[model samples]
Target: MARPTLLFCGLLSFLLSCGERKHIAIWEYPEISPSPEVQDYFGTTVIDSYHNLTDLEDSLVQNWFKTQDSLAETYFLNNDLTTQFKNRFHELEGRTSGEVRMIRTDEKGNYYYLRYDEDKDTDVLFYREKGGNLETELFDPSSYTNEKQNISYLEPSYDGTKIAIGFDPQEEFTSTIAIYDVINKKFLKDKITHINPDFGEIEWLPDNSGVIYLYFPFVEKSDPKYKKHSFSVVYYLGDNPEKRTPIFGWDKTLEIASDYYPKVKIGSSLDSYIVGYAAKSGIFYDSFIAKITDVKLGKPNWKPFFKASDKIYYNQGEIREQYFIYRRATPNGNELCQVEIGNPNFNNPLILATGSRENPITQFEVTKDHIYFVREKFGVEISIFKIDNQVNITQLSPPFVPGYASFFGESVAHNNIGIGMDGWTSNYIRYCINDEGDFTNESILDSPQFQEFKDLVSKQIMIYSHDGVAVPLSLVYKKDMKLESNNEVFIYVYGAYGESMSPFFSPTYLDWVKQGGILAFPHVRGGGEKGEEWHTQGMKELKYNSWKDLIACTEALIYKGYTRKGLISLYTNSAGGITAGMAVNERPELYTSFIAEVPRMHPFGLESATTASSTSYIEYGTIKDSLECLGLIQMDPYINLKQNKYYPATLLMPSNSDDRIPLWDSGKYIAKLQKYNLAETPIIMDIDYKSGHENSSNYDAAMDVNARIFSFAKSNMRY
Candidate 1:
């Protein structure tokens, strides 16, 4: 008898391959694989590692890249590997996921939220109706968990009179929040659309009739094309329907800030005022205190809360169009000050922080009694700083997890306070100081998914950077899990621009930890946690301060017996991709593998955003300044792929239609590595088709990718 042939052998085998599957995406991308034309555009030469005298020689990049196929085919094939790895890792990671929706208070003042149950394939809204008596109802039902369209974005208002519901129906798109009046049990005819951009937070103004706060983006009246402009307008509830005021709008003349926008953080105690940041371009994001005294919008009661200017050009010759040369760029960044919001501009705005390495202060907020903001430390966690009569920096946890904490994307309200601690071999708890200034409560609200693994320890140590700076290191290792003094480790770092990571709690315990994994974090001089003083250590092409810091952490992890060099792995996302790719190029011995997921690796992709893209200026420095060219050269990850060494086996994960980072990053980096790298490492790629900027898909799809990541780790670390 002839051997039974496998059904659809080639096609089925490809589908069943570790990376061939798809999953439920949180931020679903319409395009996972790019067109051949797009791939052709992402051709590359090489991104510098250390910039040696003969770095340009063909021999330098020979083995480092795997350029056997056309740029498109190489990325397509490699992404296949990445997907298989992620899919498997997803399944192995088990049940924990980040899918929280509405967070509200119960009758007894306890917290409640909406959660999506993947197993049940339904959206459930739970409310703390009574003491310990949580009431839950099925909100939405689907065959599988949704990727981007989540129920959490829809929130119910106080007294249950109304609910603000978000609706993003189409793929690679977003929808508006429709008010569902519970009392009337009907959908309110008057809807607020095109107010705040999707991902913008929604706060109910005092009056139940309508919203107190409105987000009016900058409108280019002259250009009827509705050009994507910068600026924001705050709307009040009592406006004469047709004449709502634009709380914070701007004219194009302001070179620093072309349009209008709102602040990153917002807080409100009454229907009276909402304090936030307005879009006034340039380096400065001055605070604005908008007091809604009346609903009749009157030129938005014009006020200026904060403002600052930066050097027209960075050190790399006016910062514009300058090819990035590591370790060189403008020394000038931003100087932030507190602005009194009541006039055309903030009066007596006190300077809070200055940008030496990159942008000055990123996030700031006024809680019940304190003004809290994060200062970008040079390539580390943002030092939690409080400003009142004097600036007080609080260490919430050991410097480890990236500082900018968000329990959920888009929504900013989260309880990210408290501290977590663990011993080298045991005991982990989240600790925090109460208002009275003492470690009052334990931060462990939820138990670890796998405490049996021993509480992962996160501690700080000093690491040596290339420039000899004593970098602060963050480490998390399983407690008493039979780990060798120098166990195989996975060092994760993101040292680009001035963004500092923060430490918070989560159950992101996944497949790697299941098999005895250790994580390492480092804060180098390229971030802003130390204030303008520290941030200055990295910026422009001199931005190497961050790269140096990342490498230092890897070397430190190995030297301190936290890990073994040849068995270690490096994992990073976005800007962190720069860290992983560059460090592997510079110090191959420190790492054995890497994961560069949806990184902004393509330098040329930093081309200016069209008139309609809202986030055009956030990642790539604002293009108006001629000097940002130098900064891009330095900060863009794709521009700095290193060559000339035995690179770690790297897995590149890029969303096919990534809007934020753009797919060019993955395409160009992969192309360059293929054509360049001196080491012939297996540069596997996981190009998530049907997903874009976000690696979210339906439920089954997500778990599959997670499963793959775990399996990949196991397969690669036997050495």
Candidate 2:
């Protein structure tokens, strides 16, 4: 297997008078013998030449990836810009006290959370007492195994005597759940394997004697149904996991589809009933309620709580004594509603709180005395509100104004709540609200303030899209920076699955702004920035709105004198690649370069018989339907690439272990781009072998990746 070589042409000066420079290098891409394949969809024939790359077992494919990786290594070897970004990243990250998340509080006021361990370079589980000023180390992957592992999920028991922790070794999607005795300070004999920490819930029983969790039947990545057909099962303490039968899932009930994911939810305050829900990759869910006693006796009678047609939001509902509180999609907005669990009537439920288009309810949690929910005003400002037993709504004042806030780990038994808040310019801090509604700072660690971030400013503006739709765009830059077209700009986009691009503090953004670069975030239609309608407008047949909205925002920025056409870069990861890829394909002259990390570049490939295809057919649309097939073809970046067209320099980053979006997707896209690109700019594919879809757990490794991205964007700037 011969590796590709980089042919460095003579460096041409673009703006030597202004002291700005760029290297002109022509890269010799790896030679691939494409095995042409064709597929017919509703009388439309599509030809794919790089289809052989999908076979991971092919030696030719493996060699090609290795050659491409070597080419990237040779291109970035000892580059001064890369080294400068790496050093600045280290200086910025070292000043902070790491990060803390997944906070859970037990009934006895014991706090459990995952905190970053600077020495081990991984997040470790820590336990803090009610009034203690110090945190005690509870669980570290280094203590149990030599392999680097991460704490995927944590759920403390109701009685505070035991806790369940899900650990993913080496960033593998396959996780295992283990029980730890809080009082005894040791791990129990109970262990459940073949669990996915990202998809479902891990609920503890009311008596603390058992746990119900989502389990996957197939663990081998080679299996066609590797991440499909997930079901919920109960695991008793010290019992054999193989002997347990599923209490809710496709096999247990005829109501659930084989491809849909099933999960179980048990309220800590209620010992009588449990909730079971099944959903694909959409906001709507089909939910049912069953008695706990019947479930234990192995004759669970599942009664319909709500159907997908009812428009109930998944993972947004909580079970109270005899009532189920949830937020449902309405024409106005997402309405907070409650229904009787015994006789669930979703058609005419009791509306506790109603939201408008201007302020849509985003998240909610049910406590013993009240129900708390968070609302967002066009994805910019966040507000918290509460509803009492008498259905009286009141807005609660947070510690900070115009910041992101959400309730987490609310104990129904103790009526205690944890609120995590942060802004575009503020560091994340946690607050504990007691039963009497008093807020107290319960943060276990404090992040150091940097002068670079202190001098930064953020502004929210609305830009009209191609369809005359107003889309929210966020801008962050140095306070002293002027709106000059000469400045470099970076746009980050992720508008899919009804997820919003919310405000949060990050040192990486500050680093870019501190270097006199502007960062832009567009709240496109596919996201839940406005409401459910906003997401539906950009899905399936209307998916083109997402990329068009991004283009509109970018054009508006340039017209407003924020940055010039050739000085801007587009950055997107995962599903956001759809927007960025299509935007670049439509208007390549607007950007100097673009980076796609673990992106889903080929929508037609997603229709193949894979786990992602089955689970995500609802969001991306299935080829079984003619209309949806047309929509998928329209948004397909790989299929839309024109021959001999001028394109910006592109850096495609694909991780070897990313099961969500395999490396072959990026490999095929880059191959086509490199073959047809008319510009002298390079189309590079960088591979990360150790990580999956998520970033690396090792601090230095993650920093190195970020530095490469920053440097790559900087190197391509025309200036």
Candidate 3:
């Protein structure tokens, strides 16, 4: 652990009690505060170390983590099925497989693709045949390891004969793609080495002209000073390297010119399929499809489609010749549409189905008659809507009752396409769609990890908010676990950028909840709860609404006799970190403590800060835009610290390799508060070295965090 240094001296702000609704014994807070000073960090001239500490803290934290990261790395790298977490969550024990993500297919009758291990360096990929013939293989990524050994992404070609493989040794080295001969067991010499590899898409052109080549233009910062900027070409390689071309064309009015959520847009005609790109305009990345109407390879020439944070999933199987059903976004901007094909000349895209305005329209598979897409709601509800002239809709899941994370099924693919539905409380029954469009074999994909959790005698509950708003929260304390009003509690909230915190079972969390701790959540604004408006409402000027709603929920927790002050904690990262931090500062009375994990908040007084593309620009008006928004005035955690006298003991953390908020935001606040804090509060600066934004992925790092959090709160928030 690193030590804290004092820079200034001032009186401590008077300590106050927990929120008015709850009570707890109190301790003294330091009355001293720091004076401002200018310093240079990472070559950037930060105006004042007191307010701008991103650079300084980043450097120090990075160094600290580098020295101590090995142990944490090994702890999490241990992929033991019986791997134990400190706070065992009883509800999650049998319910989750600990398999982070997986995918499935209909060709093999009932097959699925799953990640073999949690360790990236030694991970495996398993292909379980529909009838239960599981084949396992080591998928090494294609880095510069002297051999073609890597699996950055896996996209089985449309014909299933070739798999497009994308892998990179490191970011400094551009990712490349290769053709893995599925049937012949050979690597193709005509490998398409692109700037970045994609696992979601592949082209099976009519003539086997090889996969379409795609590329993009990228920019890299010279130093942290923000003084010099340079650009680089992210090249793409296809069939004939000699004939291959790099994509470079981009229009500012039409393109976002960013790599945040970059994807190659491909348009298929009767003859071939080519590539295109999208740029970020905040959360929305506008899409452009490749117009191979001409021979030259580059960005699409046709007008762009709407924007999306993720790819609109389409079926890998073809729809006759020269065309296939593609997932299209709602032109009216409400729900996503299952169009036949955007290209008007080929086949007119019929509105086959539409998802709720809240969740983007997902593309699963296209049959002669019905189209399958999950109708999303408080919980995921699978609904098979008809295509073309049929125009019929059917619901798949039972009506949601509350206290359930989501009714969404295990997304074997990005769109959760062609998979059976589950309400989180039950085992998943994975069925297949036969050639005649008949469904059969409702086999259970729920592993032992999931079955273990179902033994508990608890059911899901839907808790309504003050406005008759049904906030879906998953709750499972021990059956013997006391529902005592004063028990310890923690809730995680991250509601922005179309991000949905899935209700999958986590062992460590279950252990904690089972041990008499109440683990809960609030499906609040600034997320995909209701729709785009829900997220927009909690972002920017209205951003404070998220924090306020969280605070309201916390109050409701105690009022409903769920938990008491000095016994409850809040967890959030990225954008939710801002919400958690602000709530802690504004209403210190409600929280026992809070964790600001890689907080994505404006460093307030910090200088030269970069933010996430989605909510950051909206919440914190950028210097480039120059247009002032009310959001910039509010939602500043560092700025509001001076007025926060009754603040909770905080855990400030950031990853040095984190590309988003960096490390200074947490540092600046701590450096300034050390002087003025009157409480016996310790500013635990949790740092990770080699880790990127995935601060919690490492088991040891997560354990260290849990230990630190336990110690911090046990010592300071004790009643």
Listed in order, each prediction's TM-score against the native is 0.67, 0.95, 0.71
Query: Which candidate leads in TM-score?
Result: 2
Kindly provide the TM-score of model 2 when superposed on the true structure, using C-alpha atoms.
0.95
Clash counts for the predictions, in order:
116, 0, 53
**Model 1 Cα RMSD, 1 decimal:** 10.9
Q: Write candidate 2's Cα lDDT for 381-413 as tens digits.
A: 898887877888888887786558877767566
After TM-score superposition, the amount by which residue 150's alpha carbon in candidate 2 deviates from its true location, in angstroms, is 3.6
lDDT (0-100) at residue 712 of candidate 2? 82
Residue 397 of model 3: what lDDT?
A: 37
Native-vs-model 3 lDDT?
A: 0.47
Residue 93 local lDDT, model 1: 42
Candidates arranged by TM-score, highest first: 2, 3, 1
lDDT of 3 by residue, 1-719 (tens): 22232322222222223322222323222222344655443343433435423334455444433323332232222312113332332234324433424453432233324342434433344444445645645244423366634355565543345556655323222356676666665566755543433212444342334544334233132233221111112223243544444332333444444433334433222334333344332444444444454423344354554335433322222332334445543422233343333553222344545556544443344443455544445433334433433556553433232222221221212222244444434444444543233445344344444443453433334455445545555455655655567677777777666454445444555544544567676667676555555566676666776777777778777777777887877778776876777777688778766676677655344323443223245344543432223354356666555543656666666665454555566655655554445555444445654444534243343554554444334334445
- Model 1, 580-636: lDDT tens digits are 666666676666667766775644344532323444344345435546555555555
Model 2 local distance difference test score: 0.81
